[model samples]
Target chain A: MVDVQAHLPVLIVTVPLIGGILTIATGRGWKPWAWATFLTGTVFYFTIRLMMQVLASKTGMVSYELGNWPRQWGIEYRVDALNAFILLIVGGVGFITTIYAKLSVEKEIPADRVNFFYAVWVLAITGLLGITVTGDAFNVYVLLEISSLTVYALIAMGKDMHRGALTASLRYLILGSVGASFILLGIGYLMMITGTLNMQDMHDRLMSVPGILESRTVLVAFAFLLAGLGMKMAMFPLHMWLPRAYTYAPSAVSALLAATATKVGVYMAFRFLFTIFGVGFSFGMMPSGLVLLLCASAGILVTGVTAIRQTNLKRMLAYSSVGQLGYIVLGFALANLHGIAGSVAHIFNHAVMKGGMFMALGAVVYRTGRCDIRSVRGLGKQMPLTLAAFTVGGLGLIGFPLTAGFISKWYLVQGCLERPGGWPLAAVVLIGSLLAVVYTWRVVEAAYFQEPDPGTPPVEEAPLMMLIPMWTLIGASIYFGINATFTGHIALTAARSLLGGAP
Target chain B: MTGVLGIYNYWIYVILMMIGLYGVIAKPNLIKQAIALGLFQTGIFLYYISMAVIDGGTAPVWTTVQDGAQKFQGPYDNPLPHVLILTAIVVSVSVLAVALALIINIKRRYGTIEADEIEAMDIADRLAEFHAGAAADAVDEAAAEGHGLEHAHGGHHHG
Candidate 1:
């Protein structure tokens, strides 16, 4: 029984994987089956949390070798403070998104397509969870492709905006596949040099190979991995597919991907740079820190500036998502305990903020049948609760004090200032926050200040089904902000582990 | 430099990768872009396969007649990259198939597969709609401003 319990993390992913296949086999008449599968995923999420607590208490890490194989010889699934924290985020967001999807799917998706959507949703979640939990380097790329492919399908299924969604999904598919290829190539190169695919083994092997630290091949692999993961994470220049995909996707799909998908990619990047490659090999040996810093700084300014000009609420949020990712990257590039902690905290913080905001927007769309800023005028008076959730979420985006966003930005700025000549970087980070305020305030202004058209019909509040989860996430954003000790402790410990110390 | 042919093979993979990347970046058509993505993935596959090849490697499968003794030597091919590439190929094909399906749907709805043209159409529609809204607002403002004077004159005549 203890051994069985030890497999809970893997079970969390595998249950969904098997459920997806079963869902497809049952076809369209299996709504109850779909719900059951989704519920199972929710159960798995809770179990995963329990397992995380146990791991945190016991050995301070969880490692499971697949097929009863030894770690170095076969695939390994390892969860530590770093990944377990991310696993919680992915699973928690995934559970809520699944519940939200149950109601939203019935409205937006055709009856015939609902089953397929649920199947793909489960598969995507499974892939994301796998990516987060797996300790094997190549497995990340495989799981990434699985999630990316399903995401393309899910996005392409949007109602009348099929053209835009299809185009966006295609663009993502092309770019995403190429990115995965680069990752695969980079992993191949790493394996060629290290003779192992296990991340810890690769790290250990990499240390002893003479001149391996200075190998151009290693640098090339690093570049490939960075570019590949950057595209998936929607880092600024590679963010072309983001706006349209987010705007046109079924709102629930948008929420899930915004909350969890790209965050997984970010986690992968962190894992590669900080753990597998090791910080000293990457930051101390190469110019990676500078490269990441430059890209992140540019991403923050460019994407934040661009966000303010978007008229569509979803598009604006998408741009904000890009800017937020830049902040996370910047935190990682700072290359310190504070920096890594801030980045990790932001991972959780941004998810709640973006997820809540998107869910609120989805609620507005549900009530009013439009996502345009003009359409949401006077929504604050009508859908007061949903709009209030949006306000809290928006404030979080602006890094207002007592919101989760502020805590992340505080640490990130502190991280930046820890280095010499870091004040300018800190200023840029502050400017990014100000830009977030501008765009978020734009929505608030439109929602509250603009009067409703006299002839328009009155709208009701979003259904309680949707409002419940939206408020739950909003509450989490505030709750985490106030009692950040729990999250902060995990983040700090995770950062230490990532920086090569055992928790 | 002593092994001249090995260097040439590496360059071929590099050229292939660049070609695929160029096509993906330069092409505007969705289908063409998907093909380009496939080519890029194939380039990686080529690189991996080439890396796996030894001087005189045979196929990886073993025969019972050979007493299951593996022929692992300098002349044997490294099976790892081949295996990895096979999985990569499958993933690439899956992505391609989905991308192509999306393209078909795009063509069905928008009547064009050109990304630029579709974007142009969307922008033009938005601009036209924006102009119409501005025109409506102008008329509404003019009507509101005149209605005050009409109301004032009617009230005075009635008094």
Candidate 2:
């Protein structure tokens, strides 16, 4: 057990990587699904174990160098309180979505391609986990490309359903490649100055080097990294590719990407800003905080209103995702204890909420074969459980009391009140919630009040397979919302460690 | 002037990258966008490869002395960046492949790879879907109000 514990990080990534490629030989039908489920389940178990080990370790950190080589020359896999929390979120969501995906994939994708689909699916999850676990900055870029390529393929798979999916995927590929190149350029600049790719070593070198922090090269690197990550995370004005991609992708893909992809982008931002750059250089010497704060605030308002205007429910939630990400960015940009903690907590909370909501939408598509506002009219009678889950998830999005979103928002508001001239940001949060109410209410009213179309065929509730996973996520959100001790504790621990507090 | 001339490769890379970016943004053809993306990545690859160069450096291959006591050498070009760019080149090729595949799919589906034409087609599809949904709502309203009119959209199938 001790030996296995030491090798957990690399094993967690490699198992899925090998397993995903091997899934292609699984052939068709339920074979690939079963293989994927086992792989994801194993990964999820490893994540939980790693999280416990991180807590149990002396320094709240664990480092494993490849092939027993020295740290400077070899790649390392580092796990700390911060990334352990993120790994748990990604792993847990991947496992749950894999279970939900079997039914949804069959309904959506063609049979011959199902095996390849699952292969790419697991590969994408592997890339996400790999990026979260690696210590080398160059490794981050490689894994990022792995994930982006797989995601582009995944979104393009939706072309059979709608031709627009083709365009959406192409647009994303072009933009995503540009963003990735910018990141590559940034890393090149950093390597030129520091002569290292290890993140912690880079930080130390930056500190000891004379006047390097003020240099034009380092500044350019910072700008490029920030812009690239912003585009990846769909920050405000850079979020154009998101709505259509989510709207057109296969349902399970949407749930997986919505829950995990952008959250990982935020995680990368945290690493670059807090871990490598240090809070002093990032927030003090640089004007990034003020810049991020403004973008996040404007994103919250603009995306919230735009979410209300979307005719399709999936598109609406996609826009809401952009808006919710704003709160997370705002929380971290504040650079205060409560603010960063709130950011961390919301990562978990919003994952559960939005993951559950997207799963519910998938179920709606499964049953009635449509997801527009009109198809759900009078769906309350036909699919009470699914719509109820959506309604509750929407309430969580509005930060209603006794919901997980409320806990994060409460911390965020307290964080705002902690700073002078933060009240305006607080008001923006409130107004954003109000806009959420309007959009969510649109769905609830359509489902509950209006009559079902007499012309369309009658529908039933979603299959048991789909409902179970959807409710599991929704139930976890509510459970964590009421008893915030676990999430709050982990989030605060991660936040404190990020701010250079005692580990 | 010497300082600027010293880094001529970087200047060329910048020019190539901007031109590629311009094509991606300004061109309306899907295939052109894919080609432009490749050009843009090639510029970045050039940046990485050029930065790895030293004034009078040799290949990174090491040669050992007969006694193995003087096995070290000075002024070898950095191999790490070249290795890194090799992986990046693979990534770029895969991206180009995917982009071309998607372009082929767009051509198959819409019969045109022009960006504006695809946008127009998508908008028209959405408009038709909106009308169908609205027409369904009208039928529902008519039924609820006990109106005699039953068929909406003149017998067009709703679902």
In TM-score terms, which candidate is top? 2
Each model's lDDT? 0.80, 0.89
Report the C-alpha lDDT of model 2 over A1-503, residue by residue, as the tens digit.
45878899998889999999999999999999999999999999999999999999988899999888787998989999888989999999999999999999898888899999999999999999999999899999999999999999999887666667888999999999999888888888988888999998988888888899999989989998999999988988899999999998988999999999999999989988888888888888999989999999999999999999887899999999999999999999999889999999999999999999999999988876668898898998899999999999999999999999999999899888887899998998899999999999999998999888776566899988999989988998899999999899988898888888223
Across residues B1-159, which tens digit of lDDT does each residue of candidate 1 receive? Answer: 447674676788888888888988898887778787878878788888888776667776644555776654335687877777778889988988887888887787778989899778666645643443333333454442345323422221110
Worst 10 residues of 1 chain A by lDDT: A32-41
Pairs that clash in candidate 2: none
Model 2 chain A weakest lDDT span, ten residues long? A494-503
Cα error, candidate 2, residue A333 (Å): 0.9
Off by over 4 Å in 2: A501-503, B63-73, B139-159
Model 2, residue A422: C-alpha shift (Å) = 0.6
For every model shown, what is its TM-score relative to the native structure?
0.92, 0.95
Q: Which candidate has the top score in DockQ?
A: 2
lDDT of 1 at A492: 87
